[model samples]
Target: METTHGAEHVHVGRDGWLFLTAGSNNVVGQFSRSRLMARRVRGWRRLVVARVRGCERLGCRYLHVIVPEKLTVYDHKLSAGLRVKVRLSPALRLRRALFWHRSARRACLDLVGAFRAVRDARDLYFRTDSHWSFAGCDTAYRLICAACGAVPKDLSGEPQEWRQMAGDLGSKLTPPQSERWPIRGLQRDAVRVHASPIVELRERTGRADKLHVGAHVIYRNDAAGTDPRRVVLFGDSYAHFAPIMLTALIAETFAEVHFVWSSSLDWGYVERVRPDLVIGQVAERFMFELPDDRFDLKAYAAERFGTELAEAEAKSARKPGKNSDKSPGKKPGKAGTSVAGP
Candidate 1:
């Protein structure tokens, strides 16, 4: 089934899965302006590497998952006439940068290729939502686990349900107060995935870049698991769906799971918790937006761990002439530098 709306950003596709057309510009990334250029996209990939390196320093394993635009996966289902007109930007394909770049190959997980490999009667993405359907989420989760060297679970035993829903893109087409776009969920995860309320925070006070400074989420999974490593996941809304099943499996698999929902790249949270595994994810479209999120990890470490690291700096800042190095009664021996008595 193919349908067109006056709003080009929102296009109706087979079986009602709405897609964000090229002009939507609203989808996620600012990449279309860059046309996924190899030189430009490669620069973004390096920014991602810098963040991943911070996790590696903590002895934590990293998996970077990038979600491709929905149309790339199921363009076959798109209406006949508009099909030929739509093409993915080179960056979305990722073949030239992350896929082939040895520098990022280890940490990068190919979500686009992973989604393409599977053939499901139901669409990989949702008809009514901007996110992946439960099935698509399943594929992403399993691939992530596999990439991390963890065995995937048998979800077959889990319970299931179905419901009718409207997707975000479709909702854009509806009249205000209208019933909203309605789509059906044929197969849904039946096991209850109830997350406690999100813990919100604005990181590194007074950051200049608005995109880098914004609300982030923290989700703690109380469920018990034998895996001792605490896990911290960072991403936008895309991170929300990918981890639901991982939490269910992790509700009992890991010691505890924490989520940081933001595009800003900071290692302070990782430093505070010292998680055993760290995973950062983002949509492919937003890959170009990463450079703005960059920060000096060394400064973040000093600023964030100030109280814990030392009292000298804080005490010195408070008093202009005081000898911060000297103990209560100890004398400064050499040019104001405290030293053990000779």
Candidate 2:
């Protein structure tokens, strides 16, 4: 049991490398290239389509960013036992899912390959945490800007350095294992904070981590950057590494930036923000249940507009010779369900 990180889901590998158990059913098979689960991939594709159509209807550009799994970037570190379990690859499964939807295919971009190109030159992800290192976040920022068509100032010369700290995962461990490790992070001077970041709303209760009531703020230099546009970005903890940093670097490019911590899409908020670009991102392991898949949009709509919607549905149900509108208020906002996350 000590070999596992949490819930027997993480496998301790060589040189302190930690890999996630591939399929939930086979937690013991760490780094196993097991067969692709076509059904789950299909479900993810469907959700992507829904999100794309919904974003299009809102006149927003949609871009899906997928965080690379640790093993994906560091497969070489896998133990021989798990490494030889070769059967199927999740990366390929994800690619198959990507090709299933031409729309998502074209828009969705995974950074594992990109990271590989420069990984030897610099570390892109944390050695322990599921999140990326600041260097990785910087790379993602560049990619996101390119996707959003936001030209940023040359920061290659920007000062950067490595900081030693206990990451989220390492902190969970005890004893000598909890020792601080070096993580490539941005220099304080690199991130310029012209103004204080705002807190739009804090979910009063829920998981402490997800309770981070994020806000959308633009950071720009009056002397540079493209014209103002609008963007609504959503994601899991991975967003902490990319979008939030991206927001600081290219916020000026966007006329408005709405960054939601929740993986679920707040369509009502999307409508309210009316962003020109919409981005949803998540760590690769969590891709099994995409944010949109976990979220119940129908229920969210009812909860947000319940009273009037229920009234309207009841009126329609009573209409002579009309089908019953039994779906709307069957249960009071049960659809405002949870958006599960790590």
Candidate 3:
């Protein structure tokens, strides 16, 4: 993790890169490709210039700043479902192609398991909007419980209900261009997931990794006492689930669990935390964001693994098979010399 100018750090993963942005500026690339395309292309340039020129003509220089402010407030009011509806369709074909790629398919399986875990626990997702479907979250929650050796709660015995709570996240994404994708408001009914009280071992502090939180704040019962166990989690939304899910699962295994993300874990954090097991998880399409110049995944992994596993794999690959002449106990025979060769 590279510390930025503002005491903030950038997180890179084994197969991922860290793209650092300026202060208080959100990393918008976490969305679908259409959103990224719209923000980075010439189309966005024209849109911005036009707005700036319009503001100049009105002699309201601050209007340039006000436009973004207005849009951000507008987006904050909308739900990710509405935002995704508008944001994903334009890139549907691209996303579909990505979803079919071998790597992408593998990624989805990892995520699907995570989703399944959440659902099996009778907790789908937030009732107001954003994040995974309550159904999707159930899948993730279950996978984690199993992985951590925790006894999973049965969905059949848990009854889920929903109540509308006022949320401000949807209105926060104000894209500059009107030619952009469709955006919408948060849903009126969201799933209210209920589970055992999370034991928050570490008090929730603002200093604790913000990148790990992303759009959702996870809570756990930390009162279980402290014992250090190693955990490696990867992905955007997928990685975020690890902290909350494992806090539950770890209770069954290690007394304390160290949570790290592929997206945000820097070499520094790895060196400092020194977790025993590392997990890498993410959505299928996230690979597109892997080429940031700011982070070194190779160095990070090298530090984390300490060159042992790499050397072990190389050694194992060189061992001779039973049929190979190079086998220590087997002697080489001529083509027709063997008893069965004739």
- The alpha-carbon RMSD values of the candidates against the true structure, listed in the order shown, are 12.2, 11.8, 22.1
After superposition, which runs of candidate 2 have C-alpha atoms over 4 Å from their true positions?
A: 1-9, 22-36, 84-92, 153-163, 174-223, 241-247, 250-253, 293-342
Instruction: Tell me the lDDT of candidate 1.
Output: 0.52
Using TM-score, give the best candidate's number: 2
* Number of backbone collisions per candidate: 7, 3, 52
lDDT of 3: 0.31
Q: Order the candidates by lDDT, highest first — what do you get? A: 2, 1, 3
Report the lDDT of model 3 for residue 257.
Answer: 35
What's each prediction's TM-score? Answer: 0.64, 0.66, 0.33
Model 2 TM-score (2 dp): 0.66
- Write model 1 residue lDDT over 86-191, tens digit each, in one string: 2444335444456655646767777777787783564566676667655776677788777766655555343344444555666566541122222322212222
Residue-level lDDT tens digits of model 3 in 1-342: 233243231222112112221223333332445555444333322322443343334332211000011111122233333232223322222334334343322222233223333333532433222233433434554555554454444332223344333222222222110111112222112111211011111122232333332221212222343323433332354334333332333332432233333443343333443444333343323333432222344454346544544454455457765333232222233232111110
Model 1 residue runs over 4 Å out of place are 1-6, 22-39, 81-95, 99-103, 155-161, 174-225, 241-252, 291-342
Better of 1 and 3 by lDDT: 1
